[model samples]
Target: MSKDPDLELVKRFKEEGSLESFRALYERYKDKVFSTAFAICGNYAEAADVSQETFFLIYRKIKRFSFKSRFSTWVYRLTVNVAVEKRRSRKEFLALSEIGEEVFEHTGDTPLETLERTERDALLNRSLRHLSPKLRTVIVLRYFQGLSYEEISSILGISMGTVKSRLFRAHRELSPLLQRPPFSAPPGGQEDAWQGN
Candidate 1:
């Protein structure tokens, strides 16, 4: 078998009725699909459901898949669509949860370091949630998933220039969010710690 035996297996599944080949392909891409889902959904349980739904769609639609793009790209597009739909449905629920009062508290480093890091991460996530879904998708795909611009454009079925423009705009939006008040000090700002000297 070649390096990506799953590709061959997918072909076989399409040509013949090979359940084993289909299962092989499913196993090969499940983790990547799940990770993509979790990155968008931010909840492990929902991600798992989305991952399963993604594969189910793949199996049903595999016959319609053209080989014009890589299999991974096709799978990623499906996963993203499912995640986006789920997010849309739960928008009201998320908004309600956001309204709950939670005081901003930071623990120092050491065992405290982890807590501080967690708080910072939560803050960043909250900021990201404010961005439009399109902008958020571009940020997640580029930064978290580490996909190339070309890959993102292909998966999104958009022009490369559009992807670049969205990324630039997303950074512009995120910069101000990162620089506001408490987070203004930047990641490791000694000056902020010793202010009012």
Candidate 2:
């Protein structure tokens, strides 16, 4: 297949009902779609279902594609939307009560090191989970998927400024989660107390 052949295949499929064209498009984008879905859904089974649903929707709606953007970007946007909707629907069944506070406990040699690492990772995850879906999506697309801001804007159907704003907000929200422990005292306090000078 040629570069951007999926777009041509989709165009052909819409015009001629060509199964070959559809198969080619599927082969080209299957992994990308599945990977995007899996990144958001975080489960192989749900990701598989989301991937199938995404392609099914694409097939039904292929005629509506106007070629205003890359087909891959359009498909990725669909995948993200589908994954987010699935997550929202499942949220009610999966309560947040199970998120235990014992995450700081250490289980290996060098307890302090283990504790620090675990706590840091947990705090990051918790902060990410607290972000709005829009902010989280941008962070995931830019950082986890390594997409450029333009690509992310295309995928999300938003202006570049919106992408920048959401990423800035995500980072701003995460900063406190990564800052110094709230109860830590100044360095000189303990030294002054011991010296009594």
lDDT agreement with native, every candidate: 0.73, 0.71
Candidate 1 per-residue lDDT over residues 146-186, each given as its tens digit: 88898899988899999999999989888876666533443
**What is the C-alpha local distance difference test score of candidate 2?**
0.71
* Candidate number with greatest lDDT: 1
TM-scores of all models?
A: 0.72, 0.64
Q: Give the least accurate 10-residue stretch of model 1, judged by summed lDDT.
A: 95-104
Tens digit per residue, CA lDDT, model 2, 59-145: 998889887777877888898999889988884322111223342245654967866676665445445555677887898788867
Model 1 C-alpha lDDT versus the unseen true structure: 0.73
Q: Runs in model 2 with CA error above 4 Å?
A: 1-5, 93-130, 173-197
